[model samples]
Target: MKIKIYFRIIGLSVLFVLQSCEDFVDIDSPNFQMVTEDVYNKEKTTIAAIQGIYNQLYVANFSTYGVSVLGAMSADILLARTDTYLPFDQHELFSINTTDAGFNQNIWSSAYNMIYMVNRALEGLENANISDDLRQNLQGQILFTRAFTYFYLTNLYGDVPLLLTSDYDTNAIAPRNSKEEVWLQIESDLDEAAALLNKQTEYKDGERFYVNLSVVEAFRARVYLYRKDWSNAESFSSNVIARADLYGLEANPEDVFRANSKEAIWQITPDGVRNFAPEEATHFTLHVNGTGTTITGNTALSDDFLNSLVPLDKRRLWIGEVSSENEHSYFSKKYWFDNDGEIQQYSTVLRLAEQYLIRAEARAMQNKLAEAISDLDQIRARAGIDLITDSNPGINKQALLDTIMIARKRELFAEWGHRWFDLKRTGKVNTVFSSNPTWQNSDALYPIPGEERLKNPFLTQNDGYGN
Candidate 1:
């Protein structure tokens, strides 16, 4: 088990440091046949190895507030409150400061570091000395993590370099893979994770913090919906939706984001590292002077996004505001608490509402218009809005699809990169932002961080960018 122990140690490197880090940066190659590996002797240590990756996600630039902010800014949902965020909000990215700036640290570099941790843990698990159940749990967690990270990577930057192993020597110079190839790997990883996690009927320690079977199905449902595999998307989403004992829509709209809520299929506890409320509140909560001129925080909900919400919608209540003599600034309060010491809210990654949306869109695309409206009604019922079935029972498939997309924007805004990825995937970026001169066809994909290309010459920049 020398290999297991050695790889676990590499995971420590992933958690503690990742400056200019590419995938699996330290070791040239894992000497699989090396001497006695001892890290997996106890189940606790094995769990810890996987736990380290979760912690990495919490503190890592990409996970905490990075994806939400960058995605919101790039899309129409959020407007820049500070000068530093102007580039992202304007659909242009730059690196005037250094590679350590927001874009590189949050998306490119940190995501690769996240993948590295997952790869290390996956390799260690192959010959681990743990019990079968523990091994399965660990494997399920690692595989899901790899897929989750890659989901954002491929969506944010088209055709990323897919590195699945911890062999730095082979991966360092690797060229980018096609977007379709990366997606296939994502589906493959999720398929294996589903098999590994299938037997676990409950969450780890009765908390949704850890990945479980439902989480796997929920994520796969999302991936399938993105890929336009409407059949698989509807099926996987239905799997999660059927588990009523463990999940449901919180009757109260505000209660959905609270810790351990009934609606959460999977959530990351804000109980480590910084030990604060979820980054959703900490980052998106805004401060403004009682005047037209001043605002704080990196971003605030954009005028377009704010105007899009119906005035009486319950979901609109999630927006907090600071009003001035002439203007009012709005911010998202999904997490509800922003003070660093208060930990009431967990950063929600996956929830049942999203599955409903996914199912709705998938069913609509498959011409199951009535079933699609039924699914859409679940979320609307929670949001205290008029149900699609009641409002318009005869809505056409294309109109239902369009309506679900709008619901996704309203319901899932300021969460992950849902809106940003949605615009790109659905070919609506140009249509949505047609009036804004700053929006462009080329801005759909993020630039490959220049630092990454410097290290790996095979890497190329996205459209309308330079070295």
Candidate 2:
């Protein structure tokens, strides 16, 4: 199938400009008959349709800013420098107008748009006259994409409407599903995705840009870890770790974000023109001028969080200092680019380090202290930090878990809101934020977007956010 088939089916004019390849088949209009006949009939067009779902990740609202920025700002790892993002930085998201059209609104609407696209592709593939192999592959890709989107949605908003169909009527009136139900669906999707996807070794070009079997397994490990399914989490994470040839940890901490690094299980490339650089770089990088660079970023590493990193850790190299006339400030260098001025960095959604953390936490929960310590030590060794040893430390299960949490904060800080999600999953949001005068128990979950509530009357706002 040709890319036009997807654009026409979704009525997306913006995507039509992104495609440079000549159309394989021409259509007189974007009608159902034309799309069904021209798109669903061919394997190429069907693959292109699946690619459309991946393309959505490059959108500003999806991974670039919505999840990464909002997630970081709401946590202790990153601090907002201006009033524009202060609401999130100060934990005032509950105070934002439910009806306001802003980043929050964009995050909600854009995620659902991606979900709808996946569902549409799935619907088309089901009835399309295609081979079993092609059909299964497409199904796996679509399911993984849907599950990924829902993981973010459910984490941010607690409960979300699960739209599995492309039909507008069905989606419009769909009620919010419980977080448990949504998670169950996510697991089911990942299970099916794992069954259908080709292994990482089978992927051409060693690409981490698209979903593969290892990516599915890694995500399954993460989902299980979040659900406290310790044994399954450890097993799934161990499965990914066993495939070291394909998904080994990068030797250098800075190399993890480089394009197609082995550490990355899944990453999203920047879109053609508008999204030329990783979105996090814009907020985290210092401003450069004639005199010297100044740390005038929209966001920066929080002082308390920055102080927590030990000098011996290789991960500390990811933070840099810039000096102006009389003052100095610090910023994150995780997304820094090379001197060549090309966009060689990608926003990594999942990586090998996280799998190690997942297994460590799972092992700790299962009382496999020694194994958990070994996994933690592997990540620590890469970071140039002191390893946890049975002889050097008298570590109990709770103490080891605490150590693992701190390791996670230092290892994964400023990367896609891992700190924020970690705190929420471990039931430490209140304990961590109790010092803030404005902090409330209900602030754990963001309010459901107002426009969505208005569109679907069945939708209810999270507690403490009045409907």
Candidate 3:
């Protein structure tokens, strides 16, 4: 299918206004070179370019700062430990505001930048006469990256413009597509990618950080679950589980987040990419290590959140540290750099433990209560909990689903920006999230960054933003 590339901002608006007449001459310049003929000509170079895309995933300001740090920590489940100057404590960092003291352009720019790279790679591959095998590998990588990004964008901002192509000179002024349409595109891309991706290729560091067929299947399953397609969700998730030889839960819950661990289906390895050591303070909301005056200082793991951890569960002690003073409850131990403050070794994205949670939820939805419990037990078993065979006798299916949700929260706590999405997707946003009064309105679905809206007139704010 021919997807039209849109680059409306190329010649329009004030950005173009300041350019000289020479700039206009270069606007339609064909001499700029094609990425296909120029970049992807060599197999090694093409693979390196793909690796560069993965490198971009490690940028702290974009992935770590916006999504993992802010989006993950600012949930009601977590509280600010210090009250000094954390922008997220007030819940204004990523929100839409007429004034400009704090605006989160990270989500907007990061996703688009990543999308731009993927688009370039994809366009380059399509034009290049690469071999079918290598072409499929590169194609799968780009498709998975695109789908993963759009999924995050769709969840954060309900309705988003689906810009499929990167050709700026032709299509422009693309209006916002409904969440359903975006999701459909995402599903199509992932399905295609899953088929094309290789399960045998190991990542540079020999971890599952790189996208593979299994990871794409896992992603497809999660995406289906998000759209409430239980059958497809179960199918994809079950497929991944059936390949238990390839991926499964870690032996210990703590090992899942430790520096190096097997059983990782997909993750973003923080290798020579981006170091969070010096700038780790800015990446997190508050100083989990209590050094930064940002969100970490203002907030911490809530006592209720901490207390919720079962006694035998080692994850509670593994994932957090007690506050120096008696003021804050629990500071996150997940992202701490352990090379005596020299190196940061952690995966920003995780899959194994989360996949189990996903399977459990799907099984519960299908009323396979025993199977659901079995999935839950896989996670619990590592955490030192007995198998949940006879735990629920009188509770209904919905109640069992609720139990699954709680288990998900406990199992995947603070790994990625999951809690908020889990709460929102389950239609429990208004119900469970109501305890904190600020998190009201559909605007909770992330605000389109002001800069994006300012640049493109087609993008509309979610309802209740202006009025």
Candidate 4:
């Protein structure tokens, strides 16, 4: 029932972070005194502290950076060229010594740092002189933020220290919790967040960058599906899918990642970013590095993944290829060059298509084949691929599950580590990587960062990862 809270205050300036109808307070602006107690005394300052977390998310190591380059390489979805992060690409990340693990350490450290900020804000809000309405909004937003983050932490690193307070002495030496323990906290935080906000909570200038009731439901649906709470998953996902005015599948599958797209349920904005293309686009793109001839970059779509798609799949339009001296490879055109010379592309974290996929899988698991196919076919139809209703209308439950799995891989590849998490959660990881002699079942969880273990002697490493 108890959770530890890690502590750190990221030096933040909310000046350029949010560009909405109402301006967020800029911490660095001369007008505000940023003392710890005073930061939450005013409504504007409290919201600024919350939005600062959102701004820093752009700098976090986690996220669907150009579809989560780190996790994609760990899965079969992406490949890195020679002389890159080979350990991640080869499933041998565990071989790295626990001491020199910034490669993996950054991910763990970054997330907990963000969690500490959320905890600090939540504490400040408890006695903040702000109005009830504003206080509730900030509280709900950060609690959801914390739960959203913990979902990834527990998924990537099996059991993690559950931190809930901003006290440094306790968190610095805290022990780990079971994965089930982490999920309970994640759900508990989400349930609390859901109670504080509602449908009429307007999006900032009608943008999806900020979380709302629908965003909370979409994520809760994901958590339920992962837990195999089939009926709850079906019901929650159905709620979001039915919000036709706020969400819909883009008829042209390629338009889904564009900023302000109807399909985007929640996104990280590129506002005030200096010359930024989305992280995924920047990493996944391959172009001539020296000569105007050869394509170069550490990351690209893997042939194993690319070849799995049915020929003529419209989603292929998201890919671009370049060949040099008989070496040809593909890159994602999913997020491409911005026209009109403004950075408007947003990093998509959750989308409507994923909601349908979640619903389809959830419904199928419960033997609701007809309803499941109806959901699956929506993705396939928009994909310009063969629809389940058209070709496999009477498919058996097992076959329908198989088709839905393929649909998820094809649709959600390289986005937020979906393919990686899906393979692990569905128990298909070892089979997928059986050819690699270096792989083991233990590779499913990332090693606890050595730096963190050094700081907290109580932190233990994951299986197959030595201290």
Go through the candidates in order and give each one's C-alpha lDDT. Answer: 0.77, 0.77, 0.63, 0.77
Question: In candidate 3, what are the lDDT values of residues 1-467, reduced to their tens digit?
Answer: 11111121221221111121112123442222343455566666666666666666665234655565556555555654444324444444443443321335645655666675677678767756568888998799889989988887887778877877655442235578898899999999997897787564445456666777777887888988898888888888887777756666677654665443566667664345333452233333343345532223434666777778888786765555543343334556655555555543456365667777888888788888788888887877787866677565556788778778888877665655688788778777677656655655553676676565665677777764551
- TM-score for each candidate, following the candidate numbering: 0.90, 0.90, 0.83, 0.91
Candidate 4: misplaced stretches above 4 Å? 1-34, 65-67, 94-100
Winner by TM-score between candidate 3 and candidate 2: 2
- Pairs in steric clash, model 4: 4-162, 4-163, 4-164, 5-163, 5-164, 66-280, 67-414
3 versus 4: better TM-score goes to: 4
Error of 2 at 34 (Å): 4.3
Ranking by TM-score: 4, 1, 2, 3
Runs in model 3 lying further than 4 Å from the true structure: 1-36, 60-62, 81-103, 169-172, 198-205, 274-299, 325-328, 340-344, 393-395
Which 10 consecutive residues of model 1 have the lowest summed lDDT?
A: 1-10
Candidate 3 all-Cα RMSD: 6.6
Q: How far does residue 16 in candidate 2 sit from its true spot (Å)?
A: 7.4
Where model 1 places Cα greater than 4 Å from the true spot, the runs are: 1-36, 95-102, 270-275, 289-294, 324-327, 338-340
lDDT of 4 by residue, 285-372 (tens): 7776465566787777878778888788999988888877647888777776666666667888889999999999999999999999
Q: Which wins on lDDT, candidate 2 or candidate 3?
A: 2
RMSD of each predicted structure: 4.5, 5.1, 6.6, 5.6
